[model samples]
Target: MQAIHKRLQALTLLIAEDDESTLKWLSRVLSIYFKEVRVAKDAMQALELFKESPSDVIISDIEMPQVDGLHLLQKISQLSPNTIRVVMTAYNTPEYINIAVESNVDFYLKKPIDIDEFLVAISSSVSKGSILSEEIFLNEDYSYSYKQKLVKKGQESIKLTKKEVLLLELLLKNRKSIVSIEQIEHSVWQESVSADAIRMVVAGIRKKLYQGVIENVKGLGYRIE
Candidate 1:
């Protein structure tokens, strides 16, 4: 359980469910594993929140007011294809299943939700979602091999230092949201470090890569666009 919790701790999740009791209960349970959890009563509200700030993983009910989960998932897929989408519902109708499949939902859980299965599904989604792509092209010249931790620009290839690689990995993993300084320090340094130190490290990475590759959120932290 501890290992599972740690694995999920980095993810931010959005849950859309119209049932008040179910929403509250699910949110409370999921909050234990995930770093942040946002809840919406309907698909429209979920879509609005997603547009405002996208989540790494989305777990939505199949039926909701205004728009259904399939429609919401479709819009979200178009907006941010990398997001891990999950659908849950009591209805096991063929039409609902077909729609969910067409929406490309990562997981479909039956409602009267099994806690163990739900956790496993979410954990798997978070782990997979962390890697947005096999390779990330920083620009026309520079590209990063996420699996190899190698940076390439044409024929020249440079291997990132352990710290730089870790930093970049962290940024990419939480690409959808601003990773706070505290979180960065804990993840990268594994201890208390000065904010100035963090800034210096980021600056060095920018120098090695390119300017504007990483965006600083003022006092918050950093994010890779």
Candidate 2:
């Protein structure tokens, strides 16, 4: 656990679980290595903490009151989806597992935690960084390295959800031009999405960008210029 702790301590982790005992154990384990470990007893609290500041990795329980893991994952995907996520569950339900996969979770572990194995899994996931090629750049404003799967803005690096990165890449590829809504949908999700879907994604991006980072061309697609 010493080596694992060293690697983990280099990161900022967020743990979302309602169980006090489980949270305590996790806190102890992570505290041994992680410099900072943020805890949220419920999904709402997790969301609040996430909005306040994102983490390098997130470990959440699948079952919890207020907001379940699945819903929290969805929100994370919208906000800071690039962070590595691990979902823990006590029951092995096919339906829940399917949802976890769909949510793009890095790992799903059954309860009755094995300290050594869990540490190994965390080490593996942390090394992977953001899941996807970091080589793709999102224009002059943001640069992405597929190898690191990292997104950077000028001197500062910003964390982007996978979906957000995809959208930004598409827009950058079509800079100074109005990318059609359908085109964006096809390129990003490989399927057509409603205006609301696009709008929601745009809103998420805007919130992060926070200062007219993306421009909306009325009745047309969005652009970075």
Candidate 3:
């Protein structure tokens, strides 16, 4: 067994819970272990936070005001497929079970959550994920490593800013289609930014990593292909 508990200290967690008490209690406790624990009082806020900066692992309550956890998890899944998703619900009926399975949820926990069980769920998830390395090659010259979060060209290694990396990843992930300005702002920039600001980032990446690779779609968005 790996030292999964030790890995918690380096990972970031996002918890979406409606109940005020549960949210507060969860934030207070989980903060002790995980390097960063972000709490959202509702699923909408959770979605926004997730868009701003996706968490390594997400824990969401099933029931919410406007949107439920299942829906949120579905959106999160589309946004970041690598993210580990867990749902908590008081009602563990066949309906929810089937929906959870359909949503590709890694684990389902009942309400009145046990901290130990939560930890075990997280540990089990880590154990199941690929231990092998992952690399994304941008071109014959440049390649990126998911583990190192860095791109390399020839013998020199280049590091990217958080926004730069997010922008690069977003564009590369959706290489088939245009990444709309709205999507880029939501995923790459934490807050709203002007088109010029976005262009600057793109220009920087082009100058540094892959020149003339990223394409612009007028009045639409950016794309790699």
Highest TM-score among the candidates is held by which one? 3
**Residue lDDT tens for model 3, 7-82:** 5766689999999999999999988777799999888999989888778789999999999999999998777666
Per residue, candidate 2 scores C-alpha lDDT tens digits across 1-225 of 666675676667889999999998898877777668899999899877765555667888988996798789777665544567788889878987898999888788889667677678877765664422325445557666543544677788677787787787666544556766756766667666788888888888777666476788898778776
Question: Which scores higher on lDDT, 2 or 3?
Answer: 3
The regions of model 3 sitting more than 4 angstroms off are: 127-150, 153-155, 159-162, 169-180, 191-200, 211-225
| Error in Å for residue 73 of model 3 | 1.7
Best by lDDT: 3
Which of 2 and 3 is ahead in TM-score?
3
The local distance difference test score of each candidate is 0.80, 0.73, 0.82
List, residue by residue over 38-146, the lDDT tens digit for candidate 1.
Answer: 9999999998777656677889998887788888988777555667888999998888888789888988889978877877876775566543555777775888886
Candidate 2 matches the true fold with a TM-score of 0.58
Backbone clashes in model 2? 6
By how many angstroms RMSD does model 1 differ from the true structure? 9.6
Candidate 3 lowest-lDDT run of ten: 126-135
Model 2 per-residue lDDT at 34: 69
